[model samples]
Target: GAGVSQSPRYKVAKRGQDVALRCDPISGHVSLFWYQQALGQGPEFLTYFQNEAQLDKSGLPSDRFFAERPEGSVSTLKIQRTQQEDSAVYLCASSVLRVNTEAFFGQGTRLTVV
Candidate 1:
């Protein structure tokens, strides 16, 4: 029963560079979601997937952000043309059952655009 984990818990990038962050969800979970939380703000849903099917992605801030869950398991979130405004904590969560269950969150991938 591996918990969700995100790498490079902290990242510093230039204003125009691209970056990719990784997320490892729990074993055998069916639903996965990504969120972005700005400083002192709530986590906003970025996207969601059930297995390999991406169910929702309405919260992605711009076209520069892309995410995928290729094998119905591990996922990656990529941001192109990083911006100072894009700095935030990217969070990943997963659940075993679909019914309003609490989503366990990693410490988060904190991105800082300089």
Candidate 2:
């Protein structure tokens, strides 16, 4: 894909269930990021990766939330023990290695927790 790609555009999970979201970034893209967006709100950074190394994950809400870019190209986000408050749109973005570069976003995965 030329840009970021996310799977399972929509998902429904029962409360207390866990969910996993996948992201495939552009080939050779050195930077990848995960963001969470609540209804009517802007996306908030959740994690970042530089190649296979996770640079930062301070934005994750809890220890139950996890993200990884094992091979530097594909990333995954896992949410454990889902709650109604965890329902939101998860967005993935990728950009070049340099600073101030524009990021390309995927369509995002919308999770609705019942």
Candidate 3:
């Protein structure tokens, strides 16, 4: 059962609510990514980390979104000032190699901001 795991499988957030989603990746995986998916759309890359270093975060929608992998194993994504447009599925994935390598994905956390 060692794989990418995300908590709060479903969340209902009131407007402006602050929420933190968690991801526990498989051991020794180096590439970790966060993605957002809205209805009728494909997953959009949010950010990524290689080991404990964040290599890209340009996909983050706004300053209210943040992600970190301090020790290179577990990662957390924080979203503040939630808005209706923020409602979507947050997915966490990990791979043992680079970005183009095969990756394992979590079941995903569905967030609904109302």
Which candidate, 1 or 3, has the higher lDDT? 3
Residue 22, model 2: lDDT of 97
TM match of model 3 to true structure:
0.97
Q: Report the error of model 1 at residue 64, Å.
A: 0.4
Q: On residues 8-81, what C-alpha lDDT tens digit does candidate 3 reach at each position?
A: 89999999999999999989999999999999899999999999999999999999999999999999999999
Of 1 and 2, which scores higher on TM-score? 2
* lDDT for position 69 in model 3: 96
Candidate 2 lDDT, 17-49, residue by residue in tens:
999999999898899999999999999999999
List per-prediction Cα lDDT, in the order shown: 0.92, 0.93, 0.95
Clashes (backbone N, CA, C under 3 Å), per candidate, total: 0, 0, 0
Instruction: Tell me each candidate's TM-score.
Output: 0.95, 0.96, 0.97
Of candidates 3 and 2, the better by lDDT: 3
Model 3 / residue 83 / CA error / Å: 0.5
RMSD of every candidate to native, in Å, equals 1.1, 0.9, 0.8
Q: TM-score order of candidates, best first?
A: 3, 2, 1
